[model samples]
Target: MVIKKVSIIGLGALGILFGHQLAKKMPRADLRIIADQNRIQRYQQNGVFCNGECCDFNYVTPEEPCEPADLLIMAVKFNGLKDAIQSVQKHVGENTIILSLLNGITSEEIIGEIYGMDKILYSVAQGMDAVKVGNQLTYDHMGMICFGESETGLISERVNVVTEFFEQMEVPYKVDSDMLTRLWGKFMLNVGVNQTVAVFESNYGEVQQEGPARSKMISAMKEVISLSEKAGVQLTEEDLDYWLGVLGTLSPDGKPSMAQDVEAKRISEVELFSGTVVKLGKRFGVPTPINQELYHRIKLIENRYTMIG
Candidate 1:
């Protein structure tokens, strides 16, 4: 089936990047930005800027009845996933393909539990260094999305449809044979880079250099690699090295989403990264000292806000 109508939730960094690309490539009427009434009004007034160019987007409120989208992109934060799922309900048709761009390993499952798993695809968004400050987004690399069926070596019909849509949109994507491993690799990257950066208030440049930040980042990821073995994914040091190469390609001045969240004084996705690793470490009888420390440090950072307020 050809994917024509596309609906996307969450207008953050990645959302703006993809949305802008889609708007440029496809007819404006075919893309829908789903949000509540207040957000729609606020976005219309303030406008969303991608690299200083104001995007002309079609915004639809969740309550407004419309044709079900052929593809639904969930770009909301882990904390906001539940509300986002509810918000996009009206846009989901029986044939709608769902892709959750949220970080960590469990988002697909979380989304699949509500919508049927049949509608969900395992996807990992990697190699992007996009940063959003307020409504403005800046990035040098737009990144590529890797998505496929849960089973390896099976190119399903839905995967091909999404692949064709991405090609038309001029967005880079890869159809992986083993999507689960790719997702876990992404989870490992976030568990390390996002947490360490958030705790130290650093950017990609800091972590890219050989120092405490980079050391702590790799160490935190090592803990996940250990847990992956027991959890059955069994990520190797090679996977970790692959992410390091990707990190080197990012804009040194750019930051991860968690670091951006901390700088903006907003709630970050510590829970999704370190929090998830810590939980899985315990479940799999693995030790996660690096992640435990990172988790504690980030929580302290969050606490300072409450203490000051």
Candidate 2:
């Protein structure tokens, strides 16, 4: 299907970056931003500003969220994915291509139950940073995002449309035969960064810069590597370096969506990242002591946040 109008059903940092980029590239293409009461009003009041390499996006969210569209890109946190999907699915159509842009190993399969895999496209996003200072968000280090449907042997016309959109927006993206590999790779990266930071109570640089902290980070990554092997995906040493390179470029103060949740005294995605590794390890009869401990520690912090609230 040739996609024109699109609705981004989340107003998080990722959602904003995605909606803005889509609208910027195809202005004639209808792009709507759907946010919950969370930060909907503030977003609707400002629009995304793609000012060079800076997070100067003054994006104003649309007051009226469109009732679905030909394309629906979901950038919401996967922990609350059920609610997020339920909220937007009613507005979406059978023809709408759903893009699960959330970080986690479960997104595509979970969404598959709700909307068949045929209707859902595998997607991954990189090189974007977002921080919400109150109602406003700042972002930079704009990177590439990619998505496409695997139509068996049949050539996909939708893949070309998505690639064309990326070309215009200058978002470095690609469509590979094993998008599943890319998804698992991204999940492993999150398991390394988000899981480690939450467990250590530190930022990206602080965690990577310190000795013991860096060791913990590597141990956590190794656990993921083990799980990847059992799950039939081999993550090489060079792969570890590539992901770390992305973190190296991050600003010391720049935080992840999971970290933001921790700061706001809310539950985080430990279960989605490290928690996922530990679970898979159990299934494969592999030991994941470090990942298991980190998962529990972070969950304790997040649970406390929920309890006190």
Best by TM-score: 1
Number of clashes recorded per candidate: 0, 11
Model 2: residues >4 Å from true position, as ranges? 26-29, 36-68, 149-155
Residue-wise C-alpha lDDT for candidate 2, range 1-309, written one tens digit per residue = 566767776666776666656655666436665555545554446533333223223222334444557777788887768877776755477777778889977788888888788777788886566676444567666666756664433337767776766676666786765666667667767877777766666777776585787778778877777777777768777777777777777777777777777888777777787777877887999998988888788878877868888
* Per-model TM against the reference: 0.98, 0.84
- The stretch of ten residues in a row with the least summed lDDT in candidate 1 is 300-309
lDDT of 1 by residue, 88-140 (tens): 89998899999999998988998899989999999888888999999999899
Model 1 stretches with alpha carbons more than 4 Å out: none
lDDT of 2 at 280: 87
Best by lDDT: 1
Q: In candidate 2, how many Å is residue 306 off?
A: 3.3
- Per-candidate Cα RMSD to the true structure, in Å, reads 0.9, 3.8
